[model samples]
Target: MKLSIIILAKTDTLSLFQMTLNCIDSFYESEKNIDAEIILIESNKDYEASGFKYPDVVKVIIPSEKFNFHKFLNIGIKAAKGDYIALCNNDLLFKEHWFSEILSLGEDQNDIMSFSPVGKPKINTSNSSFEIGYKVMTHIKGWCIVVKKEIFQKIGLLDETFDFYFADNDYAMTLKSKNIKHALVYRSHVVHLEKQSVDSEVKSKNIPKELLSKYKIPKYLNDNQYSWVFNNEKNLSGFLKFHNKWGSPKLLYRKNKLADILIKGKLGYFNRFFLRLKF
Candidate 1:
């Protein structure tokens, strides 16, 4: 297939998963020329992907009862067999011709190691005019990073040592360290409902399930069905290792970034302040 998407669903409610599938089907109804396959990696057998209509979309069930972000991401990437691989979260709603934009960009710039889906920008907007290709980017939105299969061959898959946090940044730093390029795609678009896998005191304070339902953001699965709770304990421990491993300018840059978010933005949630962090 031309593009293979890897969705690591930690714990997705069946209705939410159906909504995600429906979103993809809606977008691709027009882009029929592009042969794409979605590879879903389920951390457990919470829901059956076989229930979906897209047969070409493959599903891999890894028995990670407790989700480890990097581990399942690596598992998906290793299993992917596309010219391009898109690492995704299950809570996204894609915009029109998202595939065309990314695939076309890859043709012109070959050194791109990663791309952030034209995410929930400060300005919520999307345009398909690829008039300008991309902006050189330092940070990749881990929720939606698209890279060539070969980049993995070059830089290697995620450092499992990261376990849950900063793996995307670590990979980005590795690319920067080697003088490889990455970018923010200005043209394409995908709506990342930054609700799932968050609500952690470390990253994003959990948006109440009621709030999520009110906004129609796909929600946390049933506790009896499948559920994910990010481990703050692991997140802190992982960050320290990341701080040490990619030290100096790299880690310093990350530290600065955390400082910026903690200082500049009002994420509304008080507890997850990175700048307030002692370490």
Candidate 2:
């Protein structure tokens, strides 16, 4: 089955586009069985105006309005004719044989909706599996994920509810609710140049207080739910706090753990404890 790669891109980051192309080129160098088709979903006219060339890219789709990541991803998925579809951000760089590794995983497990390594932990060679308990939450970094076309048909599409964050988790949760399995293929890896599309300085100053507050862990989550959200936040905050010292990662980690236990129970404690090992 051919592999169709879809990259949701904007006009500002041409370097990121080049990096993605290089990643695809490396994939082809290692594995020749796959037919790679790229769909560049662009919302800006500057990209068209720049006249950047994607020699290997099969098609490009430019939207008239501002880009809605999830919506455009759904559009690309529908346009894909391959048996397997890969959805990724324009900033990700894949390792050679990444597609081959995903194909290997899919060969034995047809139920998998998508598969990629958990990027929270440093990418390394390790083989382990444990059920996350609450519900399997897929980060969908928009960096690297491979899914069968049928799964997309079954699950409908990414919920437009989340214009940015939580859309992937929501989609994974939806698949889990229907008993579909999601796997993590550690062997296939991608380096995510996170938030490369958006200007970090602008985002830091411009994102409203309300939006920042929205990303916080809600008070209502149960032990497992709280643990999941807390871990996700901790991962993000750990990196941010590391570089900027906005707050102490240790303090935030402990505070979140205590909050989870107080709000939920022992399950939260265990989840938090388990997460700490990775840090």
Candidate 3:
């Protein structure tokens, strides 16, 4: 099946841009047969106007109105022509045979909604081959993942309300709700320089506010269930550190509690308490 790779980006640091380009070039060299195209969703008009050049990229201009992650993805989804679409963060540098590994998974499994590697490179790779139920609550990082085009048609685009963080989890949950499978392509490795695409200044100001105010754990998820997705150690720690330092700790704590309740379930109470203790 043909694949279209969408790289979500803004005007990022020079090093990040080079890293992303290197990854794309590596993929091109290794997976020559895959009909791949790169789409760059630029948030800066000036950056877009500069006309960055890459061999296979089809540039799509996004006005710098407000940064809406889900909306940007929807735009790219509409433009994608491949049967299988890969959503990759601009901060990622991929392994040479990454596409080949993902393609191999798709060949064996037709019912998969999406597929991703088991863990982030460097942090953990021990569980690479582990296979678990698709519905098992866990954090699904969006840095690199391949999805079937039909799954998008079924679930629709990402919920724009979640401009950034929770969108990936929400998409995976949506697929799980329908019993659509997702596989872990252990053989495919992608290095995610997480958050590299975000402008440091904007991120310092906005991301905390968004997580504290705009982000809410859906009512449908129970405490334990919610904790699995939102209260995971890394997610909670990162949020606490950022918001506590820049924004209102009290408000963030309350919001975090709500997130624990809605996403994690009753077990989230302890999870939240534990996270607070660590922080």
Which is the leading candidate under TM-score? 1
Please give the TM-score that candidate 2 achieves against the real structure: 0.66
lDDT scores in order: 0.61, 0.59, 0.61
Listed per candidate, the RMSD to the true structure in angstroms reads 11.7, 9.6, 9.8
Model 3 weakest lDDT span, ten residues long? 130-139
TM-score of 3: 0.66
Please, what are the lDDT tens digits per residue for candidate 3 over residues 1-279? 678888776654566557667766766776777777877776755663555554545555575567777788778888888888888777766676777777776777676568776445434447554243333223355676778898877677876655665456556545544445677666777776667666554333223435644445334333564443343333543343334332334544554455445443434334333433323
Model 2 weakest lDDT span, ten residues long: 129-138
Per-residue lDDT of 179-262 in model 2, one digit per residue for the tens?
455666656667776666754432332333454464543334334533433334433333332223212345545644554454
lDDT of 1 by residue, 10-89 (tens): 44456666656755565466367787777777664645564533345555556554677777788888777788888887
lDDT (0-100) at residue 86 of candidate 3? 84
Better of 1 and 3 by TM-score: 1
Pick the winner on TM-score between candidates 1 and 2.
1
Flag regions of model 2 displaced more than 4 Å: 118-141, 199-202, 205-279
